[model samples]
Target: MENKVVKVIIGILVVSVVFGTLFFWFTPVKDGKKQLDQIKMNNNYLILLIQVINRVLKLAILTTMKDLKIKLNQLKFQIVLN
Candidate 1:
């Protein structure tokens, strides 16, 4: 269930990134200063989005590692009993 949720979130993020890139490229700005400012704002948002994705990935990795550790300990306990 968690894996499915993560995949959905990642899919949505990828789609949004593509849409934002297209919007930014096609947007028309008559004022040079305004365009520069808008581009900078978009860049900041992109950076933030990237950071969020990285954090999610890190969380998934940590969770998997914890689960593996638990299973390894369980196996070791069983081996010792037998």
Candidate 2:
């Protein structure tokens, strides 16, 4: 269902972000200063990307929760009838 699909998408995004952060932080590099400078230069872009991803994650979770609530209510109503 749509709820399952949304949950899967959220899981995938969360996993990717975790691995990406680990790789970004722990991966070996040749020049520390140069790497630092590069990261500093791209900081704004990184912040923007993180913000966009955060918004997407929030929206996905909210919709999934809403769908789940609707499904739960339907089930409850069915049980009451039975």
What clash count goes with each model?
A: 0, 0
**lDDT score for candidate 2 against the true structure:** 0.74
lDDT of each structure?
A: 0.84, 0.74
**Per-residue alpha-carbon lDDT of candidate 1 for residues 1-82, written as tens digits (9 for 90 to 100):** 5667777788888898889878876788899998998899789878988998898788777777888898899999999999
Instruction: Give the per-residue lDDT of model 2 (tens digit) for 1-82.
Output: 6667767766776777677666666666689897897577456545755886787778877887898898899999999999
Decoy 2 TM-score against native: 0.55
After superposition, candidate 2 runs with Cα above 4 Å error: 1-39
TM-score for candidate 1, please give it: 0.80
**Cα lDDT, model 1, residue 71:** 88
Q: Ten consecutive residues with minimal summed lDDT in candidate 2? A: 40-49
Off by over 4 Å in 1: none
TM-score of each: 0.80, 0.55
Candidate 1 weakest ten by summed lDDT? 1-10
